[model samples]
Target: MRTTASFHSYATNHRLVFGDISSDPKTAIAKANTINGGKNGPFRAFIVVGKVFTKNNFEEVNGALQDGSVSVDLPMFFTDGEGLPEDSATNQTDVVDIAPNVTFLNQWGRLMTDDFIIQNATSGSNDRKTAPTDILITDKWPSNLPRLSKVGFAVPQTAERATNNDKTIDATSKDASPLYHFSGSESFWEREPFANEAGKHTRFIGLAPFGGKQRWHYAFTLKKDDTSTPVNATECPYLKEDKVEEEPLKRANEDDGDPMAKKPRIAPSDCFLCLSNPNLAAHLVVSIGQESYMAMAKGPLLPGHVMLIPIKHNPDFCTESRPSTNPRHRHPVRFVSPKLALELRKYQIALKQMHPGGVVFYEIAKAKGVHVHQQAVPIPQEKINNVENLREFFIKEAKECGFRMENNGELRDDQTNYFRIEFPNSDPIVIKLNRQNPKFDVTWPRKLLAQWFFGNKERGDWRNCSQTEAEETEAADKIKGDFETFDFTR
Candidate 1:
């Protein structure tokens, strides 16, 4: 018997994570360059809308053009709202995160362009109502989208004017772009399809471009960071990459039994996690980047379990060799550097791609002490969307364990000691570990994952599931092979 392999009916939109609002186009481009494994090998274009941003704030969009990170691309401006007078200063999220045009209609069938005005307009109220036309899709379709025309494939022939409120028809222009709506050909303007891959769209799912929001849409692609130069502080004065803030690695408390939470101060030479440590398990190392490395977990909760470790002993993933030059006698703790962050992302994405199902990441970050490393485990595909679940799960499990877990929303990276549950497509759920109780189990995440994955909670204690050195080597080799394409170091 022959069988056919199945694929996701449509592509899923993955959001480009930008920490905060920035007017620098270089920062946005730099962030866009970091996405990997989304139906295509790399994204050729990215978009930034001028809505939630100041009116006509095209600084980053224009900056992207000047930096040569992207080509000169025209901005598509969305028409105004269908009212006697649509508000000019509306706050909207017009940035469209497109999914691949896998399905011809996207369950929208053949919605009309003026469907909104036709259904809602009242008679004798205003003489400015324009009759809406229809746009049909899902008929005879093309093998791909954006036909020969880079401008548009399905052009919006005619549409509703910004001053349309029914009753007496206002003098409408013969040539107007279709009113932006959730259905029909007008909806196509939001996605602005330009074929680039076999499946999946580069843009994450975004709102706005919905009905009304005057926006001059701008899109630009990221240049390969390798070929292009890095965005230095010279370009954007507040470039975070240029900053170097390090802290002294602290020794674990003598009373504390959890070894992962604390470590010795000083240098990599004395740290077990460092390459200089003679007892380090070299065979379990999967891939090593310039600043960071990944290795299979000593006792994996599952087959592909791994740890993202810095090449040096420090937890913050920064290295300071010239400590003597500093006026201060101590090393300031630098947060995750860009290179390290990219490597970490590549590794995490590599694991997620390998699993086909998604992956889960949990970290116990003790700022002052310990080699900060996060443990990743492959989870079922069904669980990937349940982003808020980890908090409730931990709360329930904590009560049974004779302890408590806080759904701490105010936790920041600078703060020490916290448990973080993370997913690729979702916001991380962070729970601050209470220092006073001392009842929190360090291995609680391991145990929970063990129960969910292996159907055996005992495996949470690595001792119970520990493998031989040879077996570990084999597991590492398999993972290394699977991750060959995804590994950025390779």
Candidate 2:
């Protein structure tokens, strides 16, 4: 894995140089001296996108380091490349200080200057705090980051030889990919720097490999405000379209040559909580939102017991890993969108207002056949004091269950295995459970508390006290009457 370190400073204009170099240290040093001699001389740094040292080139590298004429004054950074010798002292995470001002960026790392930020595409730990990056340099292009370049490069199937026809060029291009400089592929030339899709005047220049026939070196002046505008839909032209081919329909004659043959049908989900199934009591629905709906619990933990469930089937309120190609790849909160969050909050507020005794939102995300739902039970005014000890009890119970409690009560990494939120006031008390424990059940907290307060084991399970159609309808009518005026949309 590769890690990144960011350095930030303020400056009006900063000049940085970029180029590709091989194991020949003399050439690397000469290029630096040549750039120094130019009007844009004495650059902030020199970024080498290829191998800095080869297995048999230690003598030349050592001679360059010893010679004062070839000494590099500005910081020189280089990433991993083919033919580079492995340093026993430096690991993937550790950056090697080769010379006075030259640094090996390892497999993956980041370098930031007053004018720009440079990052490599190796997965690793990140510094707790960092600044935004301007330029991204990696061995292989990152599929997730904003595309700042108009040209796209991909390795051809036939690696024995490089061909221009194998590379696809899009003349009508638009993207915000940063000024990316990369090597290790077939060397190509760009006559002029191309502007980003955002029309921010930011440019991308691909540096050809060292000793290539065409241009191999690149240098440009960078301004503090040369940053790209945020990428929009039209700007991201590199997004791949999902091509799902429809399955061919089978002819009736194919099935034993019988036109009357019937196709196998999928059975409906047996879980009554799933709204899609016939077993679900639609009459119990109290309020419906875009992403979630509220319904009367099958068995009343209390008269106002309600379940908040997502409209779509979700196992739990935890962060899910999505493909990089997806625009919504980042983890969400309880719901996938802010609109869902607002809807849920509205219901919570309305429920609390209807039952001022106080509402306790509890969820057991690990239950079998569970369609993620939170059990919102209104606590009696007299039992409000007992609820204070509830947090302490659960903390002790979690420790006994062999799960360490995080100091912060908030969800960790968006994994909401078991959590209890007290309404009206106070922060939520969340418990991340150990999924490996077969004996552990997330529902135990709510079940035990219900037994202690209501003194009815049957009340803990909704199935134990199933309501008739008439009874469910009555409960739903009463809930709707109480909650209709409090709808957030209104």
Candidate 3:
């Protein structure tokens, strides 16, 4: 059900009231009482309210709202069988959806009560045609009469329907009456072709000078230069996901910890090809390396999504990694080669051919402080499991990858167990390098310490957070003091 201005012509400017469930329990109870026929109340009633979906819960002033239109979210209620309204009563008769520029029930309150009601409304029309029209002029001097020029106009097809009757006019008759002539006839008569191929097929004339000769005529045809006729190709290539044969277990000597995890982590942050690893230094130095990197992540996340970011910072999403021959828009920083992008695509194809996932690519150019690197995200849509099933599958995969797991479940919140898979092959060396170069000095040790110390607190203690407020306050004050006295220079 909808309402427009035309339907409510008498009070189009007023707000309409609707019954609905209320935010307040008391108001809802009152509405329910009134509708349920308590002391002259109706036998049944319900309330509805329109809400906008937004970041917050449905709020009166700030919550979600759909622009230009309003949709009502059906209300909740508790009712006995006898109180249930008939399906028709609850449907077209009661619920209303409204939008702008549409006509709807006018004087709804009074009209709704009518046993059989009809409302009339009109919808507006569209703009008129702006196509150009052709004109023709002719000069004719009768041999024995005074010279005269004839000018006339007809709206092409508008005249055709007006005069359907056709009669041949003799070329030599020179009658003072309208007449039609065949194509080869010497006598000339204006033949306005159908707007739709009017002149070519069966001929039709819209208007003819009453038995007058046609000195000149205007007509439309295919443009002189239009030689190529558009051909619609019914045959198109179809793409189907390639099937992959699962590789036999050959336990990859890969480490359990993320190989590049200890390195500066960029997106493609999960497994697959990571751009931030120094192990990839040789590859990144050349164009081919970037593609190989993108390929690696493609298998695990299907429909491989990868972006080869240049080592240089580019703030734009579409920054070309390659230099353009034309310099006006040439990027100042180094870029990846087309060869590299092609190699990456090849790698993607290889992954797709052997993996269950598809490939997708996205580049992150907005690096705040992290090292510049392109990320390849593999989205294994097929491998995606519900959250409830994710843990077991991920664990199995980690084990298969030879990742050593250290159960840190005791150090988790919500009594949930934690499992850390160590890429022993990757982390120790990364940690060593990070220590040597302070730039990547992340909080691995501190994080572990924090987890061991406070990540897990009994549920009883968590429920009574205020009990530790004083201790937390003191700790914060001490930290603030320590920070205040620390050296300003790093």
Candidate 4:
């Protein structure tokens, strides 16, 4: 993970030296020193947008460090731009402190200045703790941010850039509002500080390689109210062009490049349950709802085994969590979203009404190939009294598997990795499993319990008892007959 260091109480008047010093560190240091009034200047830090040293200039850096010409007390933060070192050690960690005050901000690392939260351009892991800041520093500008129509920066080629370009920037939020965004592009570009319609200000500046005759140096004073009110994209002076470039009109006689030349839609590569693929058994859908749907299981664990899945692709059952207000609770409440929770409850009700024996709902929220789905296995009436015994068996099995079984009151949503809910208003049994351990199989506990319940190991797997197309259709028909009158809409 990328690390962040904040510098509080930094003087507003403190100057920040920004440039690419990879070609010549000696001259860069000399220029910085001169700009800071010959060594004792008011400069608080040096922000290097690109690499600090090139392949051929290693000796120059060595000489600069050996001569003690650079100030040791001043903080120097450098980001690895497009030109990253090939060494493995530098790429392994997010941030590395090479010297007392010299830090390398590996891609995506953040350096929190008094007035700005500077971040490099890299798709890092999600971190919710860091707060938004006034200015943002990145090597490559995010396409979601306001773009300059006249600027000559090369069009972004990354897939994320294309995806971000389709999203609207939320200018009102502090996380999106930045007074200045300094980046390093393929060419030199600059957009003078301008405010949008709502009075939010931003100055975009992109520096080319060092030593060009074109404009490179920029100086600005940090203001207290830099990001007070947010602005809209329409108000930005450098907003991108809205209309597409004109194209030659196609002749009426000629076919206009295949009237039906639209690309075919494809299912998500990660999700196997998406109904887009005709080859998949989506034809066996028993009942469809606004948020979720029910389908006959591919393999029957019982006479009427079925699965409930979300219409939209959800990675797992517990996708969101919130702090609980329960006065007696010691842990945060972990539950699905309101819509998903309601849908699950509805599915449980429908399944219980159809299967009088009993319904066992089990879910594993790990990174398994199995898309988020709850398995509803019907227990015969004779075996319904043994449900409590099965619950005890699960607890004992979980303990043997090194998982700490927690009561619903004690389990935090974030800590829960597995859970089982019995139909007819039974309490959910949450299990805290270690996600980091490779040997920790999330599907084992339920599979073992299912085997014990069914008395046959093969019964745990639905694929082992594959149903014929006609049988699947019959099952779907029966399920639909039972739930046709039920309300499953959002």
Candidate 5:
């Protein structure tokens, strides 16, 4: 039997800390002064230091980047109790501290330069062959003063090189795989892929891009525990994924076949979700710039529980990836747009308040193989106590939010939180629509504006479909050709 091997790799984005002229000594001093809350000028002393991982027979240390900087707690240059250089006339040499406490932020990475020193003497400093010889670096002359730019260890990229014993460390010997570089395609919160190799589980890790082309790398030894408890953060880097904003928009109107029968596909041209049923309207809870979703409430395996989606969707608030695309092809995912994110925040705050003590579940439908609207379901922990009760909760919620639920589903609500286009004092987009029709009444324009601005353009078929049956048929044909599937296995 031929055995196929698959290795899981991890990717992460981290900013570089030290590199280029911006990281010069003078520039570093200014930044340090600002961080210390002092005016920029001459300081008593300035330094830069860092920890680098080189391939050694005995692995003694590991490194990581924090807050766009590198961190390494290695041994100091020299221990305390060491005597300072004596003042000499003929061989005068100014001995600064071998280890000072100055930290330097560089483009390559942040350095802790506070523990080293520059040797300056009043005598013939070049003749300091008489200086301490026990140091790792002893000078025959005065040519080796380590600084931010001068200090760095080549990080090995290959697993063997990183884990092997060698004098001349080859940092770039790592295999040409995704694990060596960060995946620009994914968000920060998404865990890096992991795979098993020779009875050992290894996780591939990469850093965020810095200075145009370079990135960092790492290796995380994985634990065998499959049922590990989840961790939650207080001041989270992402929004609460469980927070409910707007209830899901219906997939298809009544008289149509099962909604799930249609596939979900994101279009490259407009970022609009082209569905099979045009008669069925989708009211997006979040704006085009914010990530949104439609999914089940208790679990994706559940029935009526569902989520409406945003084009730029995030599974969790901790780490999200948003690719920079052309404005025309961009999904309605925006983090900075005041018109969208602000309202989404309001919805999340409202959901947390309204469903006190309930757990909200979320998942992007864009998993590996499936394609459907990204939806989330809010399941009260108490509701899950009984299996039948849990199912009923989804049914009731779906109806209350408005829309007919089928396939062992029932309606619960009729009104959802979808935004309606209202004249925030008669915008121009509305004026243009009104001028196009003479016989069109005032109420018609208001409705048209709302539908045009906030409603699905494909849903315009609702006006042409004479019979309910015809509308459903037309929608079915539309969805089959355009939808894409989402895979949520991970």
Candidate 6:
């Protein structure tokens, strides 16, 4: 419906380019070059359009324009299910699936849902409409109008045409220069010459995805120069996440001050977490790596408990959280670099090896912002299989602690504050720490871990487990020596 509405708007304004049929789509499109070499010609741009053939929607927002409004990039592939900004929940509620394998939920959380979308459909146009260009199947015709889109799930389609054996599509988006290619089994080719003048028999405004070889009606033809770029593609706010695919990452700063305000910012020299801080407890330092470091727990819950901290001032989630190109988005969606994540996971593995029983890594992310630290504490080996049992306990305790716990069984893209807990051999648990609970107890997780895993509720309070400087220094040296063989940084 979104694509169809957009196509209707474009066809109404650019009737001449869309309504008129070319005995040869190529020759007629070639004519575009005659006008400013068709810089802003009838062939707006090349596009790969997805047609949604649901009974709920029948419209196709046809072709694309070169105004950088046309999009040719692959929508990207996912590993089954992953939370992403702009990604709409594809689970259907109102509709029922007749498949024997899966049962219908008949639930009602989703307000809007769609069925039968050709994810391969392109919505924008290209400059060289005459070349072996990408295939777009938005409504029936391509014209100069803004393209509209919504987050939904669909199986996309494309014409099997390509320029080389590599069979790659250079569908770099005007809005975003990402998605170089999708798997190339099918090749793309130019629209054939109606196969022996197929145009004389009948005309197709554009091919419809339903009713077996169907098309829509056309209107009057009037051509004029529409050198304007397609309106900007729909914009979705950038969100940071712990688990993300290979996408663009961005952010300037989380400065809430007025544009002109000269609010003082914390510097590494003064930050307690920074290695440069003069007041730092140097005796607690365990080992340092290129991008991260390990330090003994400030207040030891257990003798071997320690923290993995990023050397840079990153807040654990976003790698490119420093600068942003698009000002409209206060935060860019790309984050969770695989390389960095792999290293961090390796760090966790090292800790796990040191403790044959079990280990839990908990990171408290404050809504306001602070340097991130992943604290690894030991969990009894006998209790490893029972980690899932803690799920309900954590949830019940969270409410009493002044915050809510939401476990849709996936990691959320939290820009502000969230508490992440990875129990022994289980997927991480995340609880939102909304700013409303400013006085929320951050130490609550440690309390639970101490009681359930450490077998001592008293040690849950870090202050109770405090050690002297000399004792901490001696422990740190022993820890560095003990962990050297397992530490990847070494």
Measured by TM-score, the strongest candidate is: 6
| Model 3 residue 22 lDDT score | 23
Q: On residues 1-490, what C-alpha lDDT tens digit does candidate 6 reach at each position? A: 3366655444333221121211222332233234312223222222211211122221111122223232222121111111111112334222232122111112111111111111121223221111110121222222111122332212133332112111011121112211111111121211111110100111112322112222211222222121222243233222212111111111112335333222113445545467886656777777777667789986688778899877766544454444457788664454556666677788888888988777878887542244668898876666767877766667777677766555563555544356778766556667655444444555678878777766656677554565657777888888888898898886
Tell me the tens digit of each residue's lDDT in model 2 across 122-146.
4222211111234545454322222
lDDT of 4 at 210: 60
Stretches of candidate 3 exceeding 4 Å from the true structure: 1-336, 367-490
**RMSD value for candidate 5:** 27.3
Q: lDDT score, residue 79, model 2? A: 79
Off by over 4 Å in 1: 1-267, 315-334, 380-391, 399-410, 424-426, 434-437
Query: Candidate 5 vs candidate 6: which has greater TM-score?
Result: 6
lDDT of 1 by residue, 1-490 (tens): 2122212211122212121122343343444454423343232222222111223444444444446655322111111121111222222211121112101112111111111111111123211222222111111111122223333323334342112122121111110111221111222333332211111111111122323232222222321111222222012111222111111112222324343333434345435468786546788888888877888887687788888887767644433333334675354443556776787877777778887767888787654544678788877555656635655675577677655444444455344556677755556665655543355545677878767655667677664455667788899999889888888777
Estimate the TM-score of every prediction.
0.41, 0.40, 0.17, 0.40, 0.18, 0.43
Candidate 6 has an lDDT of 0.42
Per lDDT, the best of the predicted structures is 4
Please report, in order, the local distance difference test score of every candidate based on alpha carbons. Answer: 0.43, 0.53, 0.24, 0.55, 0.24, 0.42
**Candidate 2 lDDT (Cα, 0 to 1):** 0.53
The residue-by-residue lDDT of candidate 3 on 1-490, one tens digit each, is 3245433332222111121222232343344444333332222212121111122332331121225123222222211112222345423331222222111221111111111111111112111111111111111211111112121223323343233221211111111111111111112333332111111111212222212253222122212122222232111111111100000011111222232312222233211233443223222121224323222221111122223443322222222434446676432333435654565456445434433343223222211113233333333344333223333443454455444443441222111111221211122111111112222212232222223223432211111122133443343344334323321211
Clashes of each: 10, 7, 44, 1, 87, 38
Give residue 196's lDDT in candidate 4 (0 to 100).
40
Q: Which is superior by lDDT, 2 or 3? A: 2
